[model samples]
Target: MACRDDDYRFLPIVDAISAINQNVNLVGVVLETSIPRQFKGTDCFCTVKIIDESYSSPGLLVNCFGENMEKLPSVHSAGDIILFSRVMIKSHCGDVNAVFNKKISSFAIFEGKHGTQFLPYQASANFHPRDEDNKFLDCLRKWLLNRNPDESISLFGLNEYLPLEDIRVGEHLTLICKVLHICKVQENKWMAFVWDGTDAPRANMRAKKENEIENLPPLQLEPTPLPRDVLLKFPTIGTILRVVMEDDNQGLQLLNCDRWVKLVNVKCEKYAGLWRCMLMPSSKLQYLSDTEKLISESQRNYEKRLTLKRRREPFSVHLPPPSSMMTETSYTEMPFVTLMDVITHPKVTGKFKCAVRVIAIRPFQSEDFCSPQGIYRITLTLEDATARIHAFLFAEDSEYFFDGYPSDRTLKRTRNALLGVMIPSGRSNEEQQCAQRNPPWVQLCLKSYYTDKNDKWGTRKYRIFATKVVD
Candidate 1:
């Protein structure tokens, strides 16, 4: 087990610190390893820090650059002991580091009871002095076996904020970002654009399809119809959110696991006189001070944008203006039926006007029978003091009211657009239009009918379809 005097000696970390630019060998336990990042062309590099308890100095940072990075994962891990040979001692800006020489250096990893195994490297055979290398490896293995696993040198528990550039595919990370835009793509899929206060490109964070509800973070602020209600109502440009994220092939995404993300609520007392003061309504921003007024203004702007965007396209048939067809009339002129009247008399089949509050609007796919080509429908949940009922809007009517249709040309885009309108903003264009023309409540002029057969609810229900949004 004795080594010859000519054999290369492994230096202590303290000795390696003083031997800048000199080739040295050292055995240390891997403490931390960074994710591999691409440099020029296809070349990748990773940084690793290792600690040696036998030395009096601190852990040494190892820069594993070039093609040798391919073997890094297999060579060592957080708890493994590695023997680095012919590594150049490097120093810059008063910080010392060990640079692995990919062309002439080699490394051996001693993990668990696997003894010693040298990884293939350039000129690896000529660099190893067999007897001396084996003796050093054996001694290091004994020292590792005698030590407790918990007592091993590690650099965990140091929570540091990682920049967007440092994020890599398949790495779990936590980030604080601002919500830029939100769109609902499907019944369960919600996509959001976020910026992490960096110059990096905006990232897309999507709600995971599976375990969707269970994984959502608890709202730190008061409960509202939508998450980040205030931000969604007003400008979504600067709403801060703290989220736990993971990178996939698509890019950085919200972590699908439960309780991994949260919306950090700003406590006014703790953040007094800070930048968050502008975000709070009780403070100085004049326009944002009134919640009702801000929501009303935001709703108007949203409708205007949606209307202008949809109106630019050519339609198969010319549409009439809202004022021309659905003129406001007194209650006696229309004989408006209350929602309770229709619910109580399920067989009611006649034109009746009802003033009701819009609760929810969703894209409807009818299962009763086949719908015509290029025809789309929407079901609006309307509530009055008496009862709640679903009113269907079909084809051209749906398009006129909500700017949505099921035609092949605009099916997908229209569906996504309608969903986005319903989700965060809390009001559809039809609802807003109705509210504007009629204060306190909106009236729907429609015909109601009931099928002879009973449904799952065990009763033949009355169905209403709006022909116009009457005042």
Candidate 2:
């Protein structure tokens, strides 16, 4: 479940097959990786096993195809060493077959592809004696003996002052290097080059003749805003809106977004789960101005995001929501009650069942949805001697309670939480009798309706309808 920091080592691509195929999780270095017919129009993505000092078992390999592979820069050729972290697990192959599961962690290239330890000092534990596997151990001895606190040295400490003659194409540079450019990427493998080189490589280049793809750098372009005269946007359920978060210093702005939740005010980081999703014309975003603490903390987060640590700015007002804003909220956040409370007082967990006292209620109207279903409309909240939640009765239960029960004609049992109204974002969890209806790790939103009362298996009355939480 975790990669050992001390086990940080590189492995050869050849040795990881059995482990990868067998499902042993690991993290290793890239010994040799290349995509055949590099530059095929549509790049290939694949996984393979690698060989290295970490283990002999087959490890995992990841191949990024097309432009996606361009993100991986090749640092060395065959025999060029690499470093990585891998995990092993079980995975299903395609739709019909099952395969072993093992995965790799981070991957990067090095200048000295062979014969050298990346961090000589830490590596000296096993790399001393100038052995074949520990060819790069000498540097650790030199670095330790040449320590100087007052002198300014490059990021590599004393490594930068060393002449290029001390480093070679195949000689691996252990310092963490970034991918400057991707020379080639293919279906099975990706090629990368380091950024530390004094010279710049080709930004875009064609792969081999067998490759159908070409490399191109990503472009950044800002589009003009839509003119106010050009309105008439049909509201959508998931339309995204942009809100630029401001830096406290006022030097730069950072942007984030959420579904068009109607904004009533200008606020940031209010509730535990609530986020400030820009304001708009039809919303009441004015209430957001009440949050003073959140706005101040947000600025500090914004400043770090804009890379403005050195830059300063004057005090400024966070921008208000535009007149043309669309707000959207998810049904998932709405809370629902448990059926257990109906059979038991404090709780109705599988072991103990209890009955509950009904409260207020509201039935959803058909007019609320564009193309609505009656199932999701019923939301309720109820409380027993112990706790509370939401609940709803389906067509069968509603018809039976209203018409079948002839004995109850003398009294009316109108209710609130029992009718299935719920508070948004509460400790609501739903358990299902079958796997098909299993919920997620956390609370789930209401979805399906009861199609058949016969399938209830006597658990209906004991179940939850919906609920509302009080602040």
Candidate 3:
């Protein structure tokens, strides 16, 4: 069945980036630059890197640009997630001058009049994206609006619900707003939405003098910024939300702010034009406050180190060897990637020590064995990159990895993840015998699905088999 408002949970931008191809938004830290969102609102974008061809070579090169180039952010920091929306998309025919593909990116400069938001977020004990629920989703079918999406609502004084009355732009606002009308964006214009939520005095019924406006000097106000509370319309950035809690008996509460859960997965959707809910929380599991505190601390420490490193070093004349590339330092410097990228890409070798998800699994076969030892390959893209390319992690690495780990989950602490070890699927009986006869007949294998006492998955990582579909 298609999902309704109540059937989905918010996905974080970080999580969404890994599965970006599904028409979902790619979320990551916003790259700050003076270019201004308006300037590059339209253009091509691409990311590139060098790799060791086989065991050795001058260096294998791969660059994504062209049609794919339309997705790049010229000013985004290396570690930031650049969400592309409402842009012309196409693959590039490789720039002759550029190394690899000259995948230039192009997109709207201003990310639209919409602005920043900081709604309720359930930071993990370590502040990473959390997935208390493991169900898959098809698309956002409903929404949990703090106010009616279709109504022109008034902003009652601010934060009326909280005991504090001091109004701030970034603070979470819970006010009693009344509906007047619904509006939308017209050709490059922000649609005017009048509000009558407050009293006639506060309700937006005032008439603007048209002639008086024409006399005013030309102004380039950035945008009519909405408070973070206005973020309810966004499925990702907010906290635990209930888009369609229970459409049947607990029908839609267009005006009921309490009906909506706050925190959410900022990763699921792109930061672009308006979109309805695709997923909503299945449960209201209380996040341990301590977890949030710890996550904040971890982020702080990580950022502190990053800040120091940026000030300490510069460029590299030669690329680091691929095998020895993945490292603790690389994790922060580069955007998140799959194990394949970590191992294959000459630049991203070590960072993937942890942080990957299992999206699918090809069941381990008996024939895949080197002298009775199992081997397997896990396909994955970086959990935080717009790219969704798969990679391999070897059986040796899987088995030799830290103790008591779920082979199906993202490798521990490594930002790069692809479930299980990367090993060739020795599908042919002849290939199996050739290797087995030689001695170590490397056969591929992986522990795909494992569950805990309540039939819930135990690993932070999950596999989404090709045959499977998000609900």
Candidate 2 lDDT by residue in tens digits, 1-471: 232444443233343343333322232333323222223354423233233443323334444232333333332222233333333333346211112111223433333322344442111111222133333223322332354433212211222221111222222222212222222122322222221111111011121211111211111111222221221221111111122122111100100011111121222221111111222121121111112233334335435533442111111122112111111113333322222222222222232222222332333222321124433233333332122334554454343333332232121212212222232334333311111110011122222223346554223222322322210
For model 3, the local distance difference test gives 0.23
Q: Rank all candidate structures by their lDDT, best first, as comma-separated numbers.
A: 1, 2, 3
**Model 1 per-residue lDDT tens digits across residues 349-386:** 65666655444345322221125565554565564433
Model 1 alpha-carbon drift over 4 Å, by segment? 1-7, 40-43, 55-58, 68-73, 112-129, 153-471
Error of 3 at 91 (Å): 49
lDDT of 3 by residue, 1-471 (tens): 112223333334333223322322122222122111122244332332111111111211122233222233332111112222211212235321112222221122211112222211211121222242211111111111222433201111121232111112222332211121222223322221211111110001111222112232111111333332342232210111112221121112122221211112211221111111212222111111112222345335435534452211111122222223332222233332322222233221123322222322222221231234445343332221111223334455433332223333333222112222222475564443233110100111112332354442222133322111101
How much does candidate 3 score in TM-score? Answer: 0.19
Error of 1 at 430 (Å): 15
Instruction: Answer with 1 or 2, whichever has the higher lDDT.
Output: 1
What C-alpha root-mean-square deviation, in Å, does candidate 2 show against the real structure? 25.4
The candidate with the higher lDDT, 2 or 3, is 2
Off by over 4 Å in 3: 1-351, 363-389, 398-471
Per-candidate TM-scores read 0.36, 0.19, 0.19
- For model 2 the local lDDT of residue 430 reads 35
Cα lDDT of all candidates, in order?
0.42, 0.26, 0.23
